[model samples]
Target: MKLIAFCSTGMRVAAVAAGIAVLTGCGSLPLPDKPQRPMVYDFGPGLPAASSGPAGAPLALAQVAAPAPLEGLAVNYRLLYAGSGQQPQPYALARWSMSPAQLVSQRLRETLAAQRPVVNVGESLAALELRVDLEEFSQVFDSPGASFGLVRMRATVVAPLTRGERLLGQRTFTARQPAASNDAPGGVKALTDATDDLARQIVAWLAELPVPQGARPVAPAARP
Candidate 1:
């Protein structure tokens, strides 16, 4: 019985020593590498100060709306050569700083502010309101080596009514700019250019629209 007791004691000591050795070795083992975060991008310093001077009457700008697929920050692309029906796919290591709709809304406001006073959607100071629906914003690839940024949107100019809204004019706009290269950086650059182009086009369209004479100021809602 004493011999057995001694053996048990010895085994325990050996086991503890082995555990200590394993722990000591772990300190020298290299730690696992950390994952790289995706690169975040946005439209570079917006359109150079508008040379045209301060804009006309205040134009109410609404937050741009987009379909579900474009509501995220992922930088998306579609392969046209692969098939006409290919769905958009996001880049693994890149993303937009914000959703495309947000980016477009911001860009539009900046560009439009150059030509006219731009206000928020609910503001009653402006007789004209501009609402935009972003339909498509993505990089399109014809082949593995070629791509371009494309932006499509529908714009509606409306007059605010005391009860609702009246549409003054509506139009669809699209802009496509060739990628500088076949990669994400190039795609972003192209997309930025396309957005700028689209903004300019919208400005031109607004110039052609006759101001609504019957536009009434939106009345503030009554508290319950």
Candidate 2:
């Protein structure tokens, strides 16, 4: 019994020593690492729906020269906004940036199509020409604590084509809009709100235009 007792003490001491040595040799295992959070950014809702509408056909020459408004009267010429000459920025998920020039052009095109005079799909059918040149298209980041949006833009109408000649009279237009910007998710609301207002202005001005008549029409065979 005495020997058994002695042997048990010896085993306990041995076990303790072995455990201490293993722990000392292994320096503590690295603590479990904390997970990192993802960087968050915002973009507008999903990309616009794919266009399922009909393809656009070319306007006939007859449509182009159909008629001319009285002298000093502005004819409602077909509209065209190609989104050309400007670079549009790519949008990221969760972040709604200002309108892309192409996007803006598209919106303008659709708006006019829905309301204004017959807008040509391209410049070929346009009679009284109104060419818009985007002079500025950029969005600056709001500095920390700033409460307003950072969007600004400038554009000029470079020409008003009347017949074979280009009319250069009063050919400039500009628009600007900013909002109570919060770095918070809702910041984008300001941009869209302001944009809506600007769009209304454009539609109103174009709606008042006089559409020309008496212009020659292209035969249906010539229509694309």
In each prediction, how many residue pairs overlap at the backbone (N, C-alpha, C within less than 3 A)?
Answer: 2, 15
Q: Could you give candidate 1's per-residue lDDT for residues 1-224 as a string of tens digits?
A: 99999999999999998878877876555678999899999998787787777658779888898999999999999989989636999999999999999999999999999999898867657888888999999999999898999999999898887768787899999999999999899999999999999999999999888777767768532312
lDDT of 2 by residue, 99-124 (tens): 23433454455444444343543434
Candidate 2: misplaced stretches above 4 Å? 1-99, 117-124, 137-144, 150-163, 168-180, 184-187, 209-224
For each candidate in turn, give its C-alpha RMSD to the true structure in angstroms: 4.3, 14.8
Model 2: lDDT of residue 44: 35
Error of 1 at 196 (Å): 0.4
In candidate 1, position 137 carries an lDDT of 93
Worst 10 residues of 1 by lDDT: 215-224
